[model samples]
Target: MIDCAFKLQEQAFTLRVDHRLGAARTAILGPSGAGKTTFLMALAGIKRPTAGQIHVGDQVWSDSDKRIYLPTHQRDIAIVFQDSRLFPHLTAFENMHFARGAKVTTLQIRQVIEALELDAFGHLMPRQLSGGQLKRVALARALVAGRRYLFLDEPYQGLNRELKGQIMDFVDLWCRDQVEQVLITTHLMGECSHISDEFMVINGLGPTFLGPLHELVQQESSLKQLMQIGIENSLACQVIANECDFIVAQLSATQLYVAGHAKVGEQVVLKFRAEDVVIAKEACSMTSAQNRLVAKITQIHQIDGRVLIHLDAGQPIYAEITPRALSQLRLERGDDVHCLIKSMVLRVA
Candidate 1:
């Protein structure tokens, strides 16, 4: 658990936070210039807070009143900045060795290198590597360090969607097995939805909001903050079977067929953009969509000419439609609707 109450003056505003984050994995979200990076730097001990305290478990990392400040190197935390901050003169392998010192074993080093797909480029210098390769090397260094906490600041910014998904999967598995806590900062909601158990939102310099994504979606203010990046529906399900064409997962009482592979009985989260959902007043028998669920509209919110429909189909799900569709279908609160989602559109996060 991380308990923090601090204030830091940025160039534009004073970033104030008073929150206790107990989740094992937390994702930080905010718009541009919202101090998302600043908040992360403070926690990593890169920037000292102007006042208050920071406590991670039983250790006091920072306390302004006591004049006690722990340096970044002493915090037992590994951070990947927005830029791949590797040593210019060192090769990728050398950078990882430096970060791990003499403590990491050869077997552990090889495992991390393989996990991150860094073996081919390990001999390349920082200047010789591409943007995506540099990011992978930075991540490998952090993993070799074997820190208690892992902080990722927009770690997937430069990668393509397919590559981003693959690296996130690797990082998720590593965090579960090795790290005590993980905090990632990203603008895209679906990028970290699979790994983050909870979310922390920093809107400007005001108080930050922290909670499970499902709970945060219920609140209008937090929902607005999330929608800015792109609102995505994250459904927790358990894989029941893997078929020839698609994987079958059970979401409560409903069965969801998604385009992915996972072991049977493994728990997974399915994420899709709200725009991908099509709502109908009745289920069609000859539709091309692979999945359909009977849901009841619990809330209808109109934001910036778009309609956001909140539904309950054993579990909370959201869909977005234009005002024209909303009026054509005559969708209203408490009405029963069918949610049509294509299997190809669904992603296993």
Candidate 2:
């Protein structure tokens, strides 16, 4: 468990956050000046809060009433910065070596080096390493030092999507193996969906939301304001049945077939882009699409020569179509339309 309640007044801005989080993994998301970094700094003991207290599990890191504040290095937490802050003068091996302490064993450090695939370039200095290599070294150093919590600030800044997924997968495994809590700040929605289920969203006004991804995605206004065009419809679903490669899921009262592998009764989050949904006047049985439902169009939005249709079959779903197609089909509010969805386009998380 983690608890933090503090009021921070910076030179140009001020923020007040008070929340308790019990999730083992959480993603911190926000706009550019949302105090995401400031909140993290306070949790890591890098910044002193003007008031209130912070407690991780049974330990107290800060308490203004008691005049107690822990120093950064003494907090037993590891932080990976956006710039991959490695000692430029030291070799990669030396950089990782310096972060090792009495709490973390030498064998543990060796494990991190191998896990991050840093054995080949361990002897090279930070200046001679590639962008990916530097980032891996930074992650390895954090694992070697992090005895409790791990903090990541934009860990996927310079990497491509494929590499980002690979790095995040490894980080997930490492945290599970060590049974540690990780708090990461990321701007990419895709990474957040892949890495964490619980999240916290903050702005200049401080924390606005903190809960499961499914519940948070249901907030249309907040979701649109934070993600903008990247917003995808999310549904809390359960696997009812599986046939070969096809998995049948139930979203509220609506049942849909998806292509995935999951055990019966397993709960999952179903996500698909609005543009992938095909809106038609009637369901086409001859098509290869596996899921088709009749829904009423509740709202229609036009942007960039395209239309976004919000509908409700059982739960809310969004479908996007071109303006020309919309005109040809004559779709409007309160119109009943068939939403044809392909199983392959569905992403289960």
Candidate 3:
């Protein structure tokens, strides 16, 4: 278990968080400036807390009362920042070698390099590699430390859908077999939900909720709606059939066609902006929309001239529409509605 109780006081804001996280894998879900990155910095020993303590198991990383503080390099924790902090002058192989903060064997280094598919570009410098390759090299370096704790801040920020899935697969395997504790941060709720077992919702007021993903639906209905403001709605599904320009995916019992070139039986997350969803009382014929699902209205929330409708189409889905449409359609809880989606607008991530 990892315990942290800290207060950060900056010129523009004051943020406080006190919590004990026991989960093996936890995702810090928050907006861009909700102090997620700052919290990670504190836990990684990059920033000293003004008060309180940070403990991982029996090791004490920081204690304000005793003036006990360990610097970043001394801590047995590894971090992969939002930006790939690779040495521009050094080759990719050299970068990985330089991050051998712990007593890692040469065989272990070779295994990590191969696991991340970086064997081919080991001799290339950071400037010569593409953005995705650079990200993989940074990840390889962190894994070389073989630490018990790992912190990843927006690890999938620049990668394409295929690359993101590959990275996520490796991280999932690491959490299962090697890492004792892993904490990742992302502004997009849908991106990391699959890999994380639990999540903490942090906003302007700091952390508001932290618990299992299953309990999130029942315990914090309004908070979930609020978090969806800047994020797209995502549903986890498996591709059942691939038809060149589009593919059929199954989300529970409901199947929808998504425009993406995914192989059959591949797991993917379908993401679309809430505004892109069109609600209808009855299924429309001869419409240009490529996908439609019948779902029940589970929630209705009004914010900033728009009404956010939460639906249950075998799984949770959200749609944001104008207040005028809400009045015109006269939507209500428990009402059956058809959600229209254009396949082109759907992002398979």
Best by TM-score: 1
Say which prediction, candidate 1 or candidate 3, comes out ahead on TM-score.
Answer: 1
User: In model 2, what is the error at residue 74, expressed in angstroms?
Assistant: 2.5
Compared with the true structure, what per-residue lDDT tens digits does model 1 show for residues 234-349? 78899999998689999877798998788899998888898899998987958889889899999998876777899998878889899999999998999999999999989987
lDDT values of the candidates?
A: 0.86, 0.78, 0.79
Query: By TM-score, is 2 or 3 better?
Result: 3
- The segments of candidate 2 whose C-alpha lies over 4 angstroms from its true place after superposition are 101-111, 218-221, 232-281, 284-349
Each candidate: how many clashes?
Answer: 0, 0, 0
Worst 10 residues of 2 by lDDT: 222-231
Residue range 121-174, candidate 2, lDDT tens digits: 999989999987898898788877756888887776776645565566668777
How close is every model to the real structure, measured as TM-score?
0.93, 0.73, 0.82
- Decide which is better by lDDT, 1 or 3: 1
Clashing pairs in 3: none
Ranked candidates (TM-score, high to low): 1, 3, 2
Alpha-carbon shift of residue 95 in model 2 (angstroms): 1.8
Residue 12 displacement (Å), model 1: 2.3
Clashing pairs in 2: none
